[model samples]
Target: MTKLTCFKAYDIRGRLGDELNADIVYRIGRAFGQFLKPTTIVVGGDVRLTSKELKSAVTNGLLDSGVNVIDLGEVGTEEIYFATSFLKADGGIEVTASHNPMDYNGLKLVREGSRPISADTGLADIQRLAEENNFPAVTQRGVYKQQSVLGEYVEHLLSYINLDNLKPMKLVINSGNGAAGHVIDAIEAQFKARRVPVEFIKVHNNPDGTFPHGIPNPLLHENRQDTIDAVLANKADMGIAFDGDFDRCFLFDETAQFIEGYYIVGLLGQAFLQKHKGAKIIYDPRLIWNTIKLVEENGGEAVMSKSGHSFIKEKMRAIDAIYGGEMSAHHYFRDFNYCDSGMIPWLLVMELVCTTGKTLGQLVNDSIDTYPSPGEINSKLADAKTAIARVRAAYEKDAVSVDETDGISIEYPTWRFNLRSSNTEPVVRLNLETRGDKKLMTEKTEEILALLRQ
Candidate 1:
């Protein structure tokens, strides 16, 4: 039996040659088919150089396993989530690395209804089956067919906002040479047809497996300059940049200031609450006060879940949350089967900006001012657990309240912070915020970092 290092806690991801290849991917597909016993499944890939080949391998394995395959060629991860529920497929897998390095590739899986299939939800079984490489003979081979879900997917995205209310706005969309270009083009065509006065200034909008611009991850400060520069040069109303698979999107204001994902989460929650009063909004535990305050002020309930895609989606499903968001820029909508979409967020925000007569900066200024946070900061340590414990011990005693919802969220009267180890690395992530005092927030953030480092 061969142990697969590619199988991760959340999904499958690995370096190109040694960890993941066609053979391993094929076994994974067969194992998934066997585990789920699905009659049909949807499969797609990102713009990575190896994604197409790997996607084919997985699709072939599914077919050989007597599971019909619906191939949606070259799509963002959210599209797979959308298609799985949209087409009523039994399951879906997207071949993507999703902000990983050039040599790494991975898979994102979802069961029926586009619900996540992570470690707790049968991924372990699939991994075991793949490792064993033992399978019963197939009585019948499943059929394979290629189709385009772009039109329907585009229409579904349009459903998230009012077309008529989208006023004249100049926008900078940086696809980072990934899979987002096609969808943006499709949406642009729609805008043209509807006579919507939205103009797009495309930057690295073409899909290039080479990733000449960078890895398409907006989280990295160095990777964001092109988008920011484009927005400024074009004087666009807003700027949007997507990750490799486009699952998460980062935003920029008209003034070319990058908006933190934390504020985006709060803004999105407030928008959803405005639309459906008393709606439930799910947020991650890393940062909460801003989102919670917004939710309360808008006649909504805010719920906190562990900080991850699977956890957020699971909690959203459990509580029937109208919308959910993570400070990492992943936005979820109930209308989209509780799946996160990078595309949907920007559109909704655009509508919110135009209709509310506010600039992109204005929409988030108050939230940032009210509950100021420096966003998530990471500190690599020799012992991440010890570092986390040290920070908790230093503050928990004086904390007015402490909640270990995700890691350890400690709150005082005027300030709060969450310190936890990374899911995949030996690093402690610290998120600190203050009550309208950037100085105090900065002070506490530095204080926590010092403790974590010590």
Candidate 2:
């Protein structure tokens, strides 16, 4: 049995040989199966080279435990979540590192109805089982079967948007050689058949394990320029870029200006509320989103949640929220089992534009002005806890309210800040926002960073 130190607070992730390999992944599968005692398990993988081998090991282990495996080969992480809930499977796992470098790989697991399994839930149990290296052996092994859910997935996505009477627009898409290319292709084909006048500009649209361009994470300002450039160079209506497994997507307007995810959250909330009046929308507290205000004004309820996919999904399920979003570009939908999807957000936004007779930029420009935020700045610190304490100490004297749900959050009258330590990295992420005061936002950000650096 491996030590399995790679089992993180959220998922199992590690460098290829140093921490994870087929053997370790096989044991994880056995442990997961034994722990859940799942009747049927759904499995999928991204475009990484190591993913298929990991999937094979996992499936073999599951089969050995008398657990049937439904293989949805070469799909995105959200697809696994969707399939797990849609098919009412006992559990699901997706082999993906999700925007990590090529040498790293991991697995995202969930139980029935696409509920997340985090450290507090069942991850520790699985880790303990893996460490024990003992699994129940079944006399009769279960069977493995291959299935193609991509077409149905695409169709279901289209159902969320109205493609009927859409205007002709050029859309730029950079897949970054990840798992999103084929899904985009499938969706584009459907749009074509329905006579939706859309032209797709595809870049790096093939799945390449080496990630010749780089990791596909669009959160980095450096990684987003290509998509922005493509939008401008082609005079496209808009551009969208996807991360490694296509679980998160980023957008650029026709003018090549990157649209902040906060504004997108507001746009989506309004959209969802238009259909389902008074429905609840969930948002992370990192960015003091005016989106929440917008939701409330639009007669919808907005609830603050801790940052992270697992927490957001759990909160969404608990509240029966229709939609939820994080500033990191993760968007979740109740229809999609509250799982984050890189594919759904853009489609819905596009549909919003087509239905409203407005351009994407025009739709979100107002919200950007209302809620100016210091887009998540990360500072590497020697001690994250100390840095957080320093910031908290500075603000606690006159703070309106302070909460430590995920980290240190101090609320003032006009501005607020959340300094959160990352789960996987040695850095404190700072998100500051003000009630339309850009200068105060800048000053507070510098003040907090200076305190941390001190």
Top-scoring candidate (lDDT): 1
How accurate locally, in lDDT, is each candidate? 0.91, 0.88
Candidate 1: tens digits of C-alpha lDDT, residues 1-454? 8789898778899999999999999999999999999999999999999999999999988988999999999999999998999899999999999899999999999999998998899999999999999988877889999988899999999998889998899999999999999999999999999899999999999999999998999999999999899998998999999999998999999998999999988888877877899999999988888899888989999998998888888889899999999998989888899999999999989999998999989889988889988988988889888888877788888789999888899999998888887876667888888899998988888888887888
Best by TM-score: 1
Off-target runs (Cα >4 Å) in candidate 1 are: none
The stretch of ten residues in a row with the least summed lDDT in candidate 2 is 365-374
lDDT of 1 at 117: 92
Which segments of model 2 are wrong by more than 4 Å?
none
Error of 1 at 181 (Å): 0.4
Model 1 TM-score relative to the real fold: 0.98
**Per-residue accuracy of model 2 over 63-162 as CA lDDT, tens digit each:** 8888999999999998898899878899899999998887999999999988899999999999999888877666888889998788878888888877
- lDDT of model 2 at position 107: 94
Give model 1's clash tally. Answer: 0
Q: After superposition, how far is residue 210 of candidate 1 from its true place, in Å?
A: 0.6
